[model samples]
Target: MNREIMTFDNVGLAYRRSLNPFSEKNWVLKDISFQLYRGEVLGVIGRNGAGKSTLLRLLAGIIAPNQGSISKERGIRSQLLTLNLGFIHKLSGFDNAIMSLVTQGKTIKEAHELVAGVIDFSGIGHLMDHSVSTYSAGERARLGFAIAMQATPDILLLDEMLGVGDKEFKVKSGKALKERVQSDQTAVLVSHSPTTIRKFCERVLWIEEGAVKALGPADTVLDEYEETAPTRGNSPSKTTTATAA
Candidate 1:
């Protein structure tokens, strides 16, 4: 049996409606419960505004649940990878890579050592010295992804940031991501891409209207989800495949 890495028990999150003292609270997630097993690529599928990103935030400890609890193995590190990571607009891509690594608890020298791999993986070595403000969206996303991968967190919370860059880069990045997923990395992948979910995830959790509608084997849950929204499953985009270990 796989070891349990993290568990969410009836977790809930809410945001204030407004600054008004009498304003009502808006619940974003409610009664979410799940257990994450080590070395599993758990997919999270949801429609827009379904609180998918919010769920990743909850997993990353970026926010706390308003109710219930989340438990994790001691000293586990989780890194949330979004298209827009905290890159300083004025800083160079090289500098941003180091900064991101250092912020992930790596020593300065260690960050420097790992940054070479990040640069190579990103395929943005030529632009390493260029200020992030000058990078195109795809460029920025690639750099962020590279840094996140090199950081090597115990849990990687990915928020729809996969399949970055052009066709060639997509293929390369997908291969690298596949290697990680097939390894002992526990990841929670949130995506609207059915192809991505089907290809990479062993099991899936479907969220609808900010609640878990279903959680089960990838084929079963995705079959049900696609039945509800046929076009979503058929949505066209670049896709890659991997065996879920």
Candidate 2:
């Protein structure tokens, strides 16, 4: 029987601003509801400050929703949300890979094997022996992605991490992502790149003010989103009209 991999029921998130101790609730997200099934890729898009990253974080169970609920069935794993999420500047890439695997419940020997494959996949070869701080941004992203791939997650959540790499690496990684989706793995990718969304995801969700504005087939929704997005040099009208009471 097919099972739902993840579900969000009216999920909401709010946080107190550090500078505004006396302020009331400040909601970053509200009334989110969705279900994800295995073998499906869901693309999420939103304007800046629309809470795209926060939504992904909720799905990954990294933070609790301020209201409502998020549930996940067994056997779900997630990659780092961004390039710098799990990397420690002081740690070598090799050590980071080993630690990532170990923390995910692999034995030391198993971790070694996994890290070897990940290092090869990253194409970093001997660079793995150097501290992550010494690596370029693209290299660090590749290392993080490699470590996550070693985990063999059932559900993968990516948040614009692909933007860090060069064109060649982007092509390679895009192909890898396609294979993952084709192989019955559930994935949620948050990106501003419409091309990436259309290429990998079968469905798309357009989020605004933390609510889903559109959810449907990828091409249809993405087209709608593109048409509605604000373009440069366009601004809201400014007029002054007042009525005396």
Candidate 3:
């Protein structure tokens, strides 16, 4: 039997429309319920503004649901992979990398030892000593991606972290992600690319208008989603309007 690692029971999240106490709440995700099994790769797919990223943030415990509950297996650790790694602008890329690792629960010495691998993987060795403010957006993203890949989490939450950087680096990161996903790592991957979902996930969750449209075998849900996906200039059904956040 598959071991359940996490369960979402009628999960809902909302934001206040305004600072006023009387302002209405805008729900980004409503009544979402799902089960994540250990050692399985689950895919999340939806059109823009469908709250995909918000769902990952919820799973990573970065935010709490306003209603309902999300229960995780004891001692389970999750990491959400994003290119916008919070780097101290005044700090050197190397120092920022060390800080990131240390905050992720590594000792300072361990973080220092791990910084070399991050530098090698990011291909930003020459700029490692330079302040992050001096690095280009692409350079920062590369370093961020490298640091995220080094983390070992029970659940890896990916928000299209694949195929990043220059063409060569994209290939390298893709290979690295594939190795992680193919292992015993349990992951929740959100992507617009059906090909990616089909390639990596054992199951798929399709969300529309901040609610589940379908959840089942990946191919089944993907086929249904593709059939209904709006073409350019066409608007989808009116649902919650969030920034895919």
Candidate 4:
């Protein structure tokens, strides 16, 4: 059975220009309204700088919409999955793991409890104690993903995670991501590739200029998006065949 987990009603978001506080604010997402059902992997597709990431931030509650309303089920947790992951370069990977948990609203003690699993899943091994700046981008992504996965948020927001990690770790992370969404969990993924959306997402939300262009079955939405989105050529986007561990 399916249940509604989140809803957006007449939502509008805009950011004020730094120089002109009194001037017109730059609108990103406007009049956005949608319903997210439990166990549904929703895919959002848009060109670069189309307010897609901003939408994810809105969904994660990392930022509030400037107008309208976004309501989620009480006590439900959400996290946005970005490759950058936003780690402090000065902090050691081990320390950052705990910090990540704490930032997610977990208590210090709870963060400690999850640190071991995060480290293990990250596969950072002895280098876990090294400063995050010393590690490569892939390593940091591993850390970020590991921490978020351990938190086990009810909703996972993904921003084209296909680029995450090294070649080897990609398989592991991809499988892990697949398993999580395949369960009774809800996820909203932003991607340029329709293949990723088709394989993993239950529904598709096509956005243009920060507003929803189409919202329906993945195939139906993607069909129109591909036809209209000149940037997204007719060529099929390719993905990997990663196996679960």
Error of 1 at 170 (Å): 1.2
TM-score of each: 0.91, 0.88, 0.89, 0.87
| CA lDDT of each prediction against the hidden true structure | 0.85, 0.77, 0.82, 0.80
Runs of candidate 1 with Cα error greater than 4 angstroms are 230-245
> Best-fitting candidate, measured by TM-score?
1
Predicted structure 4, TM vs. truth:
0.87
Assess candidate 3 and give its TM-score to the true structure.
0.89
Find the 10 residues in a row with the least total lDDT in model 3.
236-245
Candidate 4, 12-72: lDDT as tens digits: 9988878777988989998888889888889999777777899999998888988999998
Please give, for residues 1-245, the per-residue lDDT of candidate 1 as tens digits: 49998999999998897898788989899899989999999999977877899999999998999999999999999998887676898999999898889988899999999999998889889999999999998999899889888999989888877766798887887787899987877889988898998988989998776777788889877877777684443332322131222
Tens digit of per-residue lDDT, candidate 3, span 1-245: 26999999999999997899889999999999999998888999988898899999999998999999999888898877765556898999988888888867778988888888898899999999999999887788788878877756788887877645688887887777788867778889998899989988868998877888778888877777776666512434433222211
Residue range 1-245, candidate 2, lDDT tens digits: 14677888888899886768787878988888877877888888877777888888787777899889878777666554476566778899998888888877789999998887898779897898899889987898888777777877666788897676888888778787777777787888989899889888877777776666667778777776776656412321222121110
TM-score between candidate 1 and the true structure: 0.91
Q: Could you tell me the lDDT of residue 152 within candidate 1?
A: 92
Quote the positional error of residue 117 for candidate 2 in Å: 1.0
Query: Which of the predicted structures, 3 or 4, would earn the higher TM-score when compared with the native?
Result: 3
In model 3, residue pairs whose N, Cα or C atoms come closer than 3 Å (at least 3 residues apart or on different chains), thus clashing, are none
